[model samples]
Target: MLKPSIDSLMTKINSKYTLVTVSAYRARRLRENPELFQKSEKSTSVNYVGMALEEIDSEKLTYEVRDKDETTS
Candidate 1:
């Protein structure tokens, strides 16, 4: 077995989902065999592996006011 570089590990963590913890197991597996990762399924909704960074735009979020008519005075 070979050792993985710290830079490679950091890259994986940095690329992972912001709200989720990057799996060490998956990271190691990825480094060991990247082909396996390609065939794997991302069951987690927050998984960022196969997603594009630009897909998560801030403008997509919206907020609404409820029962605010009483404050118009």
Candidate 2:
């Protein structure tokens, strides 16, 4: 079973696609730099991906939604 349940992660990120994308990107960052971890709570997992999920669960990690129109400008 995943430490941070999918249900919990959904609350932090309303869209499933956005959640996966955000976590994946964060996981990649952790892989490159082991010091980018933002979790300060009792960790439930040691892996980079798990760490990213935990950050989301603890509300330590968040994402902003930028309008597509704004990006192409």
Candidate 3:
């Protein structure tokens, strides 16, 4: 079974799309710069994507939504 359930991830994120985007972004970063983020002691995942999900589940990874109007400038 997945360590972080879908329900748990849903609570941290707004939607499944957002969750995928955030996790993908974080996973990319993890791949590029493995030193930037800290891994939890309890994490047993070997791949970056899994690590990303675990981080998100633990609230270590977070995202901010920007309004479209704010980017118009």
- Give one digit per residue, the lDDT tens place, for model 1 in 11-57: 43444343123344344445566545333133222333322111122
Question: Which one wins by TM-score: 1 or 2?
Answer: 2
TM-score of candidate 1 against the unseen true structure = 0.23
**On residues 1-73, what C-alpha lDDT tens digit does candidate 3 reach at each position?**
7878899899899799999999999889999998866678898888888889999999988899999999898
- Model number with the top TM-score: 3
Flag regions of model 3 displaced more than 4 Å.
none
Q: lDDT (0-100) at residue 23 of candidate 3?
A: 90
Order the candidates by TM-score, highest first. Answer: 3, 2, 1
How high is the lDDT of residue 27 in model 2? 93
lDDT of 2 by residue, 1-73 (tens): 7678999999899989998899999999999998989767588678988988899899988889899998996
How close is every model to the real structure, measured as TM-score? 0.23, 0.87, 0.88
lDDT value, residue 8 of candidate 3 = 88
> Residue 16 of model 1: what lDDT?
39
Go through the candidates in order and give each one's C-alpha lDDT.
Answer: 0.34, 0.88, 0.88
